[model samples]
Target: MTLPFFVYGTLRPGETNHDRFLRGRTSSEEPGRLTGSVLYDGPGYPYAVDEPGGVVHGELVTARPGDYRELLAVLDRLEEYAPGDARNLYERVERGVVRARDGLVMQAWVYVAAPPAAARLRAGGRRIEGGDWRIRS
Candidate 1:
């Protein structure tokens, strides 16, 4: 069975790494919201660090398990996955995702940065009202 994933960073569609890894393989992607998480941008990329009153803006993708593994490897190589003591950029985590229509809760994979690492880039905090992250002019 395929797994559902919540992508908040580069892996999201229209982002840099999307075409290479998730373009054709992704089954479906739609706006999804995960609460109680923070976003911090380090030297290289942004990370969704866990915190209170924090919500991450990202997409929900359903893909094969192998595809998720492949995607993890890519994130690791790019220093985006920091699971265990691997020193990766983003740490693989399981979080609750809220679908748009029915407001149902689903278990999904998410990547968050380690606390120590995130502290270095924590300027202040970011907040997205009503689940949106598009940079506005």
Candidate 2:
């Protein structure tokens, strides 16, 4: 399905990767919250680890019709995701995110930490308090 994307880190508006990867490619970008996920510190970015009862702040981004396919491919490459690849750092998954504007839940693509990374994060990685990647110091 060509669902919107739930971005919580560098891809959010004004973040480092936003201009590089998402600029001029989206028609709508709205604040949203992903429940059942916690944000963890990565090398320079933040990883959203799927864990029950957690809430991660982010945006729900809807790509322009002409940019969807290309953007998807580019983001997949940027996130190092290949279906079933053990080397992946993140895995794109469909999840429900609550739109901050209306409190409505919508399905969107979310790049969550891959198994190995998720395990490591769960075991000992520093988690961003309040689940907001931008507020981390």
Top lDDT hit: 2
Evaluate all candidate structures by whole-model CA lDDT and list the values in order.
0.68, 0.95
Q: How close is candidate 2 to the true structure, as a TM-score?
A: 0.98
User: Could you give candidate 1's per-residue lDDT for residues 1-137 as a string of tens digits?
Assistant: 23587877677788787787778666689888788876665433467766788777788888754576675566556654544775655567778988776788888877676666666546564333433444411
TM-score winner among the candidates? 2
Q: What residue runs in model 1 are displaced by over 4 Å at the alpha carbon?
A: 64-68, 79-82, 123-133
lDDT of 1: 0.68
Query: Taking the tens digit of each residue's C-alpha lDDT, what string does model 2 give over 2-96?
Result: 99999999999999999999999999999999999999999999999988999999999999998999899999999989999989999999999
User: What TM-score against the true fold does each predicted structure earn?
Assistant: 0.77, 0.98
For candidate 2, the lDDT comes to 0.95
* Model 2 CA deviation exceeding 4 Å by range: none
